[model samples]
Target: MSDWGPVFVAVVLFILLTPGLLVQIPGKGRFIEFGNFQTSGASILVHSIIYFALMCIFLLAIGIHMYIGSYFFLNATVTPLASSSKSSENHFRQALLTFSNSKPTNTSFLSLTQIGKETTPSDRRGCCGVVFVEKWLLQRQDWRGQKMADWAPVLIGVVLFVLLQPGLLFQLPGHNRQLEFGSMKTNGKAIAIHTLIFFAIYAILILALHVHIYTG
Candidate 1:
């Protein structure tokens, strides 16, 4: 993924999260339909800033998710943690530091992804516990499976952002006084339709921006 992925996520998350916040594309159409002639303005700018700040936050977090599955199998493993004779937890930190240029930071969050990439056997073999001479990377080329597994972090992050939205964090100004943007307080066909429409909007923006949620 490129920088655009975070930007797209930030924008969508802002529209979905802010209470009573109706959004308009830069050129047209109100998310809350009754608003008159929506265009770029303070409300939109502020919301953008809010989500961009939140994107910066996506880079925070000390990475408590330390240990992945142990190197009990040769069908997996990366160079860093695999490099040492013993697959200790500290080596993972060493790998992270190497990839992130000695230390992880908000800007280098994506560097962590490099640790799990499938490598050529020469790069991977003998690093971990693997004694095999056969190409571990080539033996199992499950492209679909690999991509889906790789997508977990992105999916989990998006789900967390969406799930956190309904708690009414703060009151923000919007065109709607009577209608809530995404209230879980009630269940109705209207809510279902609203969700579908929002998803459609998500699809549209994603297509328009040519955003790739995962590039590895």
Candidate 2:
């Protein structure tokens, strides 16, 4: 996919997922709130989270992953050859163990400080690969390595949204105890359902297109 592909997808998601993106008043579609309705911070939080999850899913579907640090730029310009998505080097976790597996071992766990003090930088260099731990290995870009990467941000959003409820935290101007979009007054339930539907459609469309953010 082109560099602008991800950017375009991001913009499309923002428009579709943003609540009250289009608002109209004094028109045929104008809506009126029947109750002392208002959207709490919790509602907004939920919507935000839903948007995030959908974005991740969409990106994953399109093979768009965020490279850490300067990896993306360096890999693009510096690396002569693209690194394999798989790492074929020794396990970094084993190196961290700092113990023998074939012999008897101590059960005691080392503190972070002790580990930090014991850990020394590797003097090893790579031919064309990046040195992870002490070995020249490829960066992992496969789905297996990032199975739960989506959960971290989603969980944070979920927790905040849940707390936003009951008390209706962070009452802003537009959502002042009521939720309405354009001429259509809405509740959290409706918003949540529509968000899910939007996600489904976007996901299907992305799958149909089979777009990838990067090659190799």
Q: Against the hidden true structure, what lDDT does model 1 obtain?
A: 0.37
Error of 2 at 183 (Å): 19
Candidate closest to the true structure, highest TM-score: 2
lDDT of model 1 at position 171: 15
The TM-score obtained by model 1 is 0.24
For residue 134, model 2's alpha carbon misses the true position, in angstroms, by 8.6
**lDDT to native, each model:** 0.37, 0.34
Best by lDDT: 1
- Give stretches of model 2 more than 4 Å off: 1-18, 23-53, 67-69, 72-150, 160-167, 172-216
TM-scores of all predicted structures? 0.24, 0.27
Q: For model 1, what is the alpha-carbon lDDT of residue 56? A: 45
What is the lDDT, from 0 to 100, of the residue 116 in candidate 2?
Answer: 20
